[model samples]
Target: MKLRALLLGILLTSPVATYGAGGNSVVTVNPPIPAPDWTLPAIQNAKGNLSMSDFRGKITYVDFWASWCGPCRLSLPALNALNSQFADDPVQFLAISIDVVEEDAWDFLKRYSVDYPVVIDTEGDIARTFAVDGMPSGYLLDGQGRVREIHIGFKRGDELKLAESIKRLLSDLVTSEVDET
Candidate 1:
């Protein structure tokens, strides 16, 4: 209960910029501070290579998952949907597998056909760097490579909320750019 209250307080009190007509406001919650630079192994896609630095100047969704986890499997479709929804945008959806071996993760990807980049963290180093304690943990990073939101566990409608959050962040970035110009 105490942790929940603290989280809620942070969400409510964080700095936000309001936009849109009729005074409709969108809250822009800040991401948590990241640890010092650390390298983690990534499998890249079947045909291409991807690195964490490649997503610079774009909002990135880093999801840590495993093949055998039920919630992880459940979140796959939603993650796929999110990838499709933001297909034309600068936002990226990166699903990193924490499975013990690359074979299992590759097999699962082959069966699912997720359109986004799926990286294999065969040694679980990436998961440890992200402090992931659950199978379906997620971290949202802004264009500047700062962690925006960290989510754990799976719940219904989480994908929708995540998509909305991305949209809000994108909009905020655009608005900030306009103000600067």
Candidate 2:
């Protein structure tokens, strides 16, 4: 399609690099980029909408995925575990699904268990805003909402890096709080 071709052209021209074993993510944005702020409605018209500013004091992980994306299948489960691991910490995990069909997303959720918040971006605005180059792209933001790392794809052991990033952010927050006190 024309859109896919355009996206490919953009990726080819950008600083994007692909490196992953076993055909796993293949895309990585080095030197982590700063994430843009945005708000989106909940997946099912559920309670409160998701706003980037709401999690300013917490380590935030934002995942951009689609229901039909193969990598998302693997990414979701790993993300679920990471979300659970930080349940009591000052960490927030959010998923932005680019699925055109709401039902498809709902169906996929039934197959996978996710404990964090999920928002549906039918127009793909959030993904475009983040310049997602792959299906399972993720942005790890520090407490101040600056992107600390950009993960372009998913693979086993990926959660370790994410966990470590969260730990670092939490540690930094504690240090700052103590200094203030």
Candidate 3:
């Protein structure tokens, strides 16, 4: 209860910019912060384990979701579409399921198809590490692995705004690489 209240207050007070007229606001972190590195057992689209560092030097979008989350129903499919859109680009999408019961997550995934890698955080360790304040929380990390944007809730058409942000970040990354060259 206290955590929920604190999260609500933070969301309300955070400096979030609304994208488009959909009222979908993304919390852009000024001076992007380093994302906490993690390694988890991959459940879909791969074998063994995956680590955040393995995708370094690419735009990584870390999304925290669960089967019980209502917003995830919309977010999972939408995020999958976004993943496809950037398939040819230097971007990686990771979905972390915070379901205590592993079978629950599997059942949900059976219904909604997610093409990208999905990992299960059955013990909630990863969620606690990421400080997930809300369901379907998305962290957009730049190529350097710094979290550039944070989306707490999933609303209709939120993916469009997220796409725009990704494009802007990718552009910046490309320009920086060119400058270095």
- Measured against the true structure, the TM-scores of the candidates, in listed sequence, are 0.77, 0.82, 0.89
Clashing pairs in 2: none
Model 1, residue pairs in steric clash: 31-147, 31-148
**TM-score winner, 2 or 3:** 3
Residue 179 alpha-carbon offset, candidate 1, angstroms: 2.4
Error of 3 at 76 (Å): 0.5
Give the range where candidate 1 is weakest over 10 consecutive residues by summed lDDT.
Answer: 17-26
lDDT per residue as tens, model 1, 1-181: 3334443554456566343342222334454454223344455553455677878788888888888977776688888999889988889888888888788887777766577778777777667666665667777888877777766666557787789889988997798789989
Clash count, candidate 2: 0
Error of 2 at 115 (Å): 1.1
Off by over 4 Å in 3: 1-13, 17-25
Order by lDDT, highest first:
3, 2, 1
Task: For model 3, name the residue pairs that clash.
Answer: none
Candidate 2 segments exceeding 4 Å error: 1-18, 23-34, 44-46
| Residue 135 Cα positional deviation in candidate 1, in Å, after optimal superposition | 1.0
CA shift at 138, candidate 3, in angstroms? 0.6
Give the Cα error of residue 62 in candidate 3, in Å: 0.6
